[model samples]
Target: MSDYILGSHQPLAASYPLALVDLDGVAYKGHLPIEYAAESLVSARNSGLALVFVTNNASREPEDVAGQLTGLDIPTSPHEVMTAAQACARLLRSHVQPGAKVLVVGGAGLLTAVQAEGYTVVSSTDDEPDAVAQGFHPSLGWEHLAEGAYAVSRGAIHVASNLDLSLPTARGYAPGNGALVGAVQAATGVKPFSAGKPSPAMYDMALEKAGVSSALVVGDRLDTDLAGARAGGYHGLHVLTGVNSARDDILALPQERPHFIARDLRGLLETQPEVTRENEWFICNDARVRILDGALNIDSAGEPDELDIVRASCNAVWSFVDEGGEFDNTSIPHFSTL
Candidate 1:
């Protein structure tokens, strides 16, 4: 990609009228707020960028998610949040009839969403549910999954809130909704129709709700967040504060590579720097990297901002891959300074 990926005449806050931000990794790790997440978002809003907390987490109600963000000092309301539960419920409508009996295996968020959509939510498959909706819930265990398996095996349509295998939090990355969905799928031999990130359905809904064309999808995970942004034709900003790292970005697949990469939400305040390639060298300000003989090499010795080196190397590696060039990912060094 050219420096069109590096357009920086203005800050991202001014360039995009809205920001569809991910929740798990971008806003907080577990329950604790990630550094700069709150303040930076506040600043983005002050600068005219509308903010919406878009998440694949289907366990928590939007009201609770909003409360958490507000407690962290990033003033928010339930209307400004969208959850996978809501997305999955809306998706279920297309597969089943109105007020269809649905076996819900999640938390309050999923149940409420299904109820709002006029689905008859039932905990047991004995209700002969028309569909089984699965989402992430901290308390979900073998029994919950078995219910889904039973429902699907009995001819109920299977639905998943998201396919994220791991959930990011302060404790660490835990098995996410995808893992649970996997158990149910494995038991029933049924593939679920997922309704969250990596699918443009959620983004389409959020964009319509925000009523804007130009929006940036800010996130941590590449597979869901970045992939969704690409599929939806929205510019994506991958932040290092969450699940994926600088190393992950360097080796990302074409559809999952971010339009911009930064250390944290603070990236919203500044314009991304241009990354220019000269001969075999990809240069970003004072930092430069080159891919030669299937290895990544730093062209300059002194340390540039760690992110600068990352920016340079990502462009270099991506360019290499684009041309059918292959390289050992191990040749890329890890960056520490944020």
Candidate 2:
């Protein structure tokens, strides 16, 4: 891993004409916006960067997601949004015959999006459809999977909105769309054509909608957002606001780590001279964390106290900076002293 920080004259400038940020884990989780997320979006917009909420969560339609963002004081328009569900719908419409019968195994949002694209949605009670599409939504279950499998087995095209197995939540991570697709695949012995992150389909759709070559993909997860950006030939900005933490670097890192790492949206938006050297920075939910000598060090606590957390944090930081270091929680001593 290269430890060098970006410089001002780097060929790839940080200034982007548009930014595509993930919704659930990047901008907001549930009802609350991640700390500094709304402000960052606002700042990006003020800087003349077009903002779009690109999400793999297919539970909500673009308008619904945009409405939620507007409620959170983040300015967004319906056209300035893209969802995996919408992309899947578009793909089905473009490739399949117009008004083709389609079976949907997902939420109301997915059904609504497909219907809007002029496809006849076939339910379990209805006739077997020409195509079966799966989108990630909380309400999907075995019945939907069975229907999707049956449809695919009967020669319907299997379309998946995304292949992410887990989605970040406040409690931790939960089964995502990929789980449902796995079930369908197992039952029917058919693999789905994915239309979301880690696949360039959705990113291509977003690029066409945004109409810009200079773009940045900002998200918390490495596998989905960052991987998608890399595959689609765009810069990725990793924000430590939701699912990803410093501890996840050891095993969960994607083939390509993000071009830039920020503690949160605020850290990303803060104007600083380009990094002249490799620097380590301490990141905490609190603003007191400081950046020192291209590495993060904590100085707030007294020497007699908070040793364990500090050490663990230090180890995590070092793991990121040092390519060969192993992060074995059991190997590190004095873990409880902090």
Candidate 3:
């Protein structure tokens, strides 16, 4: 909340009543569990901090998502999960009546959600559907996207789960739901309303489902997870376990910067030290960083080399950029946390 990393004397796991955790990056990447994710989450739950696994991936249902985490040794219930598919359906209710015909442009997860919300699902635009709810699924073909485009062109209100441009896979990054949604937009020349991260749709649902006033949004994507937190008026904790790196975070846009940065979920169980500005150097414990003659330099490599260096560097760089300081992007070195 302070312009950069905020210190917590108490373990972050017990600091807030609820945590709206991002699934892919924070808990697990794809189907594999991140290091210490299960243990740290279990500890937080045991300590009475409730958690809701929120995700922009609308391909899977909450039950499936919960099952995936439970198999990873992170014991979870379906009620503890929230997906963008569910959020998309909720968003539809505001624009159309319950039982209104809707075109679902994704897979079973989205179809099931739209139906559960009492909307009649239609596959084609000829059904004269009232709205189109679009999400991502791997089996999607050119035909599906064309259908969404046509439906929207006919004045069906278009809504998508999220605008994420890419999806992560074992083989590397692949096309995400947003990429497909872009095709529909290009065809219709009308942008779809996004109901995923950076829009606060899922976060709003998570808050109501958890019945909490404030929450900590944790994730690896700055554009979606962290940006959503800022938009929803909640604190964000950026974890360097997926998608984004420490340097990516150090130079994050002001609107997407996180309140806390950590190596992993273990940060939830650890105290974060203060990053202070003293003269030209930004200090975090023994770590210090400053820009000298337009060259960013680490004056000191603090204890826990990687963490402290990142913390110090973020404060120094963010402060510099915000104060109208300019430097070449390459001048900022990337500190590897892996």
Position 307, candidate 1: lDDT: 86
Relative to the unseen true structure, what is the C-alpha lDDT of residue 78 in candidate 1, on a scale of 0 to 100?
Answer: 99
In order, what lDDT does every prediction score?
A: 0.90, 0.70, 0.87
Q: Please identify which of the two predictions, 2 or 3, would achieve the higher lDDT against the true structure.
A: 3
List the candidate numbers ranked by TM-score, top first: 1, 3, 2
Q: What shift in Å separates residue 214 of candidate 1 from its native position after superposition?
A: 2.3
Residue 4 error for model 1, in Å?
8.1
The TM-scores, one per candidate, come to 0.97, 0.77, 0.96
RMSD of 2: 6.3
Q: With candidate 1 superimposed using the best TM-score fit, by how many Å does residue 99's alpha carbon deviate from the native?
A: 1.6
RMSD of each: 1.4, 6.3, 1.5
Predicted candidate 2 versus true structure: per-residue lDDT over 239-282, tens digit per residue: 77777654443234544456555667764465422322124433
| Model 3 clashing residue pairs (backbone) | none
Q: Candidate 1 on 230-263: residue-level lDDT in tens?
A: 8888889999888888899989998898989888
In candidate 3, residue 184 scores what lDDT? 92
Deviating ranges (above 4 Å) for candidate 2: 1-5, 8-14, 93-95, 249-254, 271-338
